[model samples]
Target: MGRWLVLGGTRFLSRAVAAEALARGHEVVCAARGESGAVPEGAALVVVDRDVPGGLDALRGERFDAVVDVARMSYAWVRDALDALAPTAAHWTFVSTVSVYADAAALGQGVDGPLVPRRESGDGATDPEVYGGLKVAGEQAVREAAGDRALVVRAGLICGPGDGSDRFGYWPARFARGGRAVVPDAADQPAQIVDVRDLAAWIVAAGERGLTGTFDASGPRTTLGAVLDEVAAAVGAADLERVPVAPDVLAAAGVGPWAGPSSLPLWLPASHVGIVARDTAPAAAAGLRCRPVADTARAALEHERALGLDRERRAGLSPAEESRLLTHP
Candidate 1:
């Protein structure tokens, strides 16, 4: 069995990776502040703050076959982790985002797509507009520290059970409610979403195989309408009414795209159509497999029900906003 070290393992993808590694009989250690949630049961938990003085001291002198970093956003964080664990870990896997690309809407853009310019300064709070650039900086840090031993996975929208983002999960949970759901007019627009489980499993497998280089980790290309259909089928919402509203109308009404409160999940502006239609052929050839959209939707619905579907969500349109859009559009 391989020895694995997982950074930021208390929630979402990091937690999933730790769980997958443990299930495969690997010796896993998760280092993070235990506030968000607990790590998977079997993995050893090491509580350490990565922001304070000697925060990474807990990882000093520890050796692992592979290290998967899921929460490094700043250049400093990546550099610090590399300094502490570079000599001990043989392989370093950095979980990056597709946001690093400057033009995801461009046709044929893959891992070689033009990346956003690196931030001028690594200090201060990361500007939301330059989030992608910051990620680029972090990627560079990993490559500089680990050299050819580094593996970068540029992930798209991550969904499925345990997703707190609510971007891809919104449709499934909305369909379960059985009512007139507000959907975008661009139904045929392609969309890409990777299940958290699938992404975690692939990362673990790749690390074990000592895979290097970068890969665009996303799911099979699908359309928003097709995804909604799958969600309806999964939830048995045969009579669900999909109110198709024009993209401009939604945008005029202040409905943001992709994620966050008061936004329509998986719906991007016209200019960013290429973001959802990203090419996943390379990642697929690299052993990145995605589960069916139906399975993802169903699992998300079940999770939402457990979490109380009526509760306020961090993403997706609120019931009142949906009502306004559906009734007035």
Candidate 2:
């Protein structure tokens, strides 16, 4: 194994990946603007403002065997990163999202079926609405820079320890609370979430395998309804109300987690199953193993509450509301 460098290493996914690398005895270098997340002990730092002049450029002299990029949501951001570290690493693993898939009113789309078009030009720059497109473009940038050496692992909602984003974490923690739970209209809807540790395992393995091309790193297919019940059961909670919210409500609510009352057809219908619509064929071929949703949920709640990860807090709902939700049957 060669020296490994992680961009945004102090963040959720990056830290997990860096930890795995450290455990493997690979020379690990963790870099971020500030000390945050779960930074592995004894890892070197490449501190620089992501927006400052030569901020990223400061690391030009440093070289690594591979780089795991968990940040850089925009194409320009990724471009600058590639430019700065182009000469420092051999294998580049760019963490992208499955949202790159074309808009599907209903989730059940396949990776090979039709790809979500990327906004290559126009006002597409740095727009949150264009996050998926931006990621798509960023993937292209890595391809251009590292060529066959780049591994673009497209992940779905990543959960597990240190999960900064509580999108999925909220479910388990809230479900355990046992209250009048307001869920999306379709509880049967499928939602995909990869455990942070599982994702880190694959990325490190990919580097060792020198795997290239795009691979989808996500957990096995599961539904929101099942996940909720498991979480509720885990904490010995009962009585649940299924409040349904509509997509229009989600839109009208002005964004944010609680705004929407419905799960949307994010994933529904027996044929296609639940909400996670992206294809993980590429990743499965490269070897990505996912544990059961029950295990994933259990660990998420335990870890977050015990560790109080910043990422999980980002999606945390009110404890009072949670208590109220559990009142439902």
Candidate 3:
């Protein structure tokens, strides 16, 4: 078994990675602020604030067989991690996003696709363009610093348990509620998602094998309608009825596309459709396995049940909004 260092392993994907590493009989050490949550059982936590200069000093001189960095939206943090730990880490995996691609309208592009102009520094904005630019920069930095040992995973819509985004989980939760739910009429829009567990497992396996290269990490291309139908099948209540509302009608009714409040999550605008339809064959061939949508739906529904189905959500339409749309549409 090898020693693994996971940056920001207290929550979500990073946490999943730590858990997977531990399950694989590896010695896991997670370095983070320790505020998000606890590290996985059997893993050691080295609390460090990456936002502070020299925050990673505690981890200096501690060599690791593999290191995973899930630095989101910050180029400086990516650079700092590389400067501090890249040399001592045998394998490095940097979690990046599909938004790094320049043309959101271009379909089926792979790792070699054109990327947004890289920005080594930004004002810490969370907008899509800024976020994508920062990721592009981070990818460049990782490849430049540790190309021989680097694995850049350009992940698409990641959904499953512990997903704070609330995008894909919304469907399962909504379907399980058993009502005339308002769904987007754009059923044919491309939709691709990956289970968090699958992604984390792949990352750990790749590190063990020293997998070096960039890959578009997502599931097979499928339509939004198929995804929704699968979710409904897996978790929908007996009385669940889906009402498809036209895009224009949804817009006029002040419903947002994709995510956030009053939005039909996973329903992307035409311009942004390509991000969900990437060619993930390279990753699939490299041992990135995705679970069935029904399986993901069941897991997500369980998580939603734990969080309470009626609780206010960060994404998806509220009960009042859903009712109004159903009554008017």
Candidate 4:
């Protein structure tokens, strides 16, 4: 078994990766501030704030076969981790985002597509305009630090259980409400999302095999209508009324695409459909296997219910907004 070091392995994709590594009998060590959540059982935890002084000092003298970094949002974070662990870690895997792509709207774009220009500085603040640029900078930092030992996985929308973003989870949770739900008019618009568990397993497998270079870690392309159908089936919302509203109308009503407050998650504009239709053949050839969309939908619904569906969500149309749109339409 390999010795693995996972940065920020307390939540979502990071947590999944740590758990998968543990399941594979690897000795896993997770370093992160224990604010968000806890790492999987059987993994050692090192509490440290990556942005503060002596944050990475906890890793000194520790040797790891592989290091999976899922929480490095800025170039500084990557640089700091490398400074502390590069000599001790043989392999480095950086979990980047598809947002690093400059033009995902271009058809057939894959991992080889153009990337957003790197940012001048590595500020960790979350700015939507510069998010892609920041990620590009982080990727570059990792590549420079680890060279051929670096593996970059450019992941698209990650769904399934423990998805706090609620982007892909919104569909199944909305369907569970069992009423008139507002959907984008573009029924055939493609959607791309990979289950978190699937992504984590693939990352671990790649590290174990000493894979290098970049890979687009997105799932097979699927359509918006097909996703709704799966959610309907999973939630037993056979009688659910899906009100397809024009994109412009929804936009005018103050509904934005993807996650964040007040946005209808996964409902991108018509021009951005290619974002979800990204070519994943390269990743597939590298052994990325995605689970069925229905399975993801069902699992998301279960998780949402466990978290209390009636509570305020990070995504999806608010009940008031949905009611207003349905009534006005």
The candidate that wins on lDDT is 3
Q: For each candidate, what is the lDDT?
A: 0.85, 0.67, 0.92, 0.85
Residues 4-120 of candidate 2 have per-residue lDDT tens digits of: 988877877888888889888898887787657546786777676665656677777577789888754556667877888866678899998766666544454555445556754
How many steric clashes does model 4 contain? 0
What's the true lDDT of residue 289 in model 3? 93
Predicted structure with the largest TM-score when compared to the true one = 3
The whole-model C-alpha lDDT of candidate 3 against the native structure comes to 0.92
Each candidate's TM vs. the true structure?
Answer: 0.96, 0.80, 0.98, 0.96
* Model 3 clashing residue pairs (backbone): none
Work out how many backbone clashes candidate 1 has: 0
Q: How close is candidate 1 to the true structure, as a TM-score?
A: 0.96
How large is the C-alpha RMSD of every model relative to the true structure? 1.7, 4.6, 1.0, 1.5
Residue-by-residue lDDT tens digits, candidate 1, 1-329: 99999997889999999999999999999999898899999898999888776788988878999999875456667778888998888999999888888886774478888888986345323354376777788788889889789999989889999998777778888888877888888878878889999999999999999999998899988888888778788884766888888988998999998789999989877677677777889889999999998898888888898888899998999999999887777
lDDT of 4 by residue, 152-220 (tens): 998988999999887788888888788788888877878888999999999999999999999888898
By summed lDDT, the worst window of 10 consecutive residues in model 4 runs over 120-129
